[model samples]
Target chain A: AQSVAQPEDQVNVAEGNPLTVKCTYSVSGNPYLFWYVQYPNRGLQFLLKYITGDNLVKGSYGFEAEFNKSQTSFHLKKPSALVSDSALYFCAAEPRTGANNLFFGTGTRLTVIP
Target chain B: SAVISQKPSRDICQRGTSLTIQCQVDSQVTMMFWYRQQPGQSLTLIATANQGSEATYESGFVIDKFPISRPNLTFSTLTVSNMSPEDSSIYLCSGAGGPSYEQYFGPGTRLTVT
Candidate 1:
């Protein structure tokens, strides 16, 4: 079975400060990881994904995530968070060798303080 | 990446009623999926709507409760039947490519059952 774990329920970051939302996963082999954002009363927006190759991957809205294979973690990061970045973040894991099954973590709420 | 859209951005209905949410994709897709998200939880896969077959529902989800239709390669609909307060949540539609392997999500439909 494949699953993802997000240790934090909420993360608070000051505007212009760096932000990190932690995520980890348990899958059989190399996993395809993804990050998504959701605003209140809205649907999820794709943030980024890590399939292979580079350890660090950059994505939309100046967001990036580091895929650490040894740690089984892919933590989302941003050098400078904005108030607009405050939203719910979700991490997902998909088996690269499967028929496209994506298992998502229980979301993390991000609050960028002014 | 493909653009996805969902209809009935939101709807409020009394108990025992049913509501159908429509999803449209700008480009042709092979795999279209439906998901459900509770107030603060991550998304759960509801069903996989193939272009010309019965939807493959996940555990604890049934076709009777959530009927799905995939009339073609770019359009799908999901109907939540016999709604109750527990059914109140955000419904999202996603389309993923076979070769590019990127998943695109729709804005989602917010359903409130009273």
Candidate 2:
């Protein structure tokens, strides 16, 4: 089976501080992980993804995530949080199963305060 | 990667009514997917749209309730049938050029069934 888990339902951070949204995955084959953001009334935007490369992958909007094979984790991280970054974040994993479908985690709502 | 767009960015419909959402990809893509995100919840994939075949639905989703169409490589549609308040949420469309586990999303259609 393939699944994604987001540990936190909400993450609160002060603007300018560091932020991290945790994610872990379990799959039969190698994992392909991705992060996406959704604003209040907008569609999800692709933040980044990890296929096969360096442990750390940088993505849009000054965000990056580190893929840990041993831990089975790919967590989203931002060096400095912004109020604008406050939104719903989701982690997804794609296992090369029957249809190569994306399995999404329960979202994390990040609230960045100024 | 491809740019995607959905029609009627947001709409409010009455119970028992149906809403058709259009998904357009800027470039040719081999696969397109429809997803549903309920309020304060993570995304759940509804179906996968292939260019010239029937949509492959995920568990708990059915073609009668959520029919999909993919006339070509760049255009598709997903219709929400007999909607209810529980159906109020964000509907997103995503596309991928190939099966690389890297998907790009559209702006999303916000549907509110009253």
Candidate 3:
């Protein structure tokens, strides 16, 4: 089974400060990890993904994630947070071999305070 | 990147009725998926809608309860049957396309079963 975990339910960060939303995964095979953001009343917007790539992956809206194999983690990061960055973040994972259905973690709500 | 759209951005429905949510993608996609996110919960894969075949449902989700249809590569629908308050959720549709084959999601349909 492929699953991801977001340890934090909510994360608060000051504007212009770096923000990190933690995510970890468990999969039977190589993992395809993804990060998505959802604003209130809207659908999810893809942030970035890590397949077979470099350890650090950059994504939309000035966001990036580090894929740490040893730690089994793919934590989302932003160099500078904005108040508009407040949203729900989800981490998803799937096995590279079969069943591409993504198993998502309980979301982490990020609130960037001004 | 693939652009996806869903109809009935938000709806309030009575219990015991069924609502079919439609998903349309800008480009042809081999795989489309349906997911449900209950209040404050992570997204759960309902089924995989592949063109020209019956949808493959996930565990705890049955075709009878959540019927799916994929008429073509760019279109699919998911019908929630016998609605209840427990079924009140945000339903999302996503498709895999482009060179990376990464998934892109549609604006979710917020279904409120009253």
| Candidate with more favorable, higher TM-score: 2 or 3 | 3
Model 1 lDDT per residue over A64-110, tens place = 99999999999999999999999999998888664565889999999
TM-scores, all models, native as reference: 0.94, 0.92, 0.95
Which of 1 and 2 is the better model by lDDT? Answer: 1
State in Å the error of residue B25, model 2: 1.3
Q: Write down the lDDT of every candidate, Cα atoms only.
A: 0.91, 0.90, 0.90
* Candidate 2 displacement at residue B42 in angstroms: 0.8
Number of clashing pairs per prediction, in order: 0, 0, 0
Supply candidate 2's per-residue lDDT for A66.
97
Chain B TM-score, model 1, reads: 0.96
Model 3: per-residue Cα lDDT over A22-99, one tens digit each = 999997676788999989878888899998869999999999999999999999999999999999999988777556
Compared with the true structure, what per-residue lDDT tens digits does model 2 show for residues A8-96?
99999999999999999987687678998988777788899998989999999999999999999999999999999999999998886
Please identify model 3 stretches exceeding 4 Å from their true place: B98-100
Q: In model 2, state the lDDT of residue B63.
A: 93
Misplaced by over 4 Å in model 2 are: none
Best by TM-score: 3
Order of candidates by DockQ, top first? Answer: 2, 3, 1
DockQ of each: 0.57, 0.63, 0.60
Q: How close is candidate 2 to the true structure, as a TM-score?
A: 0.92
Model 2 RMSD in angstroms? 1.7
Q: Model 2: which residue pairs collide? A: none
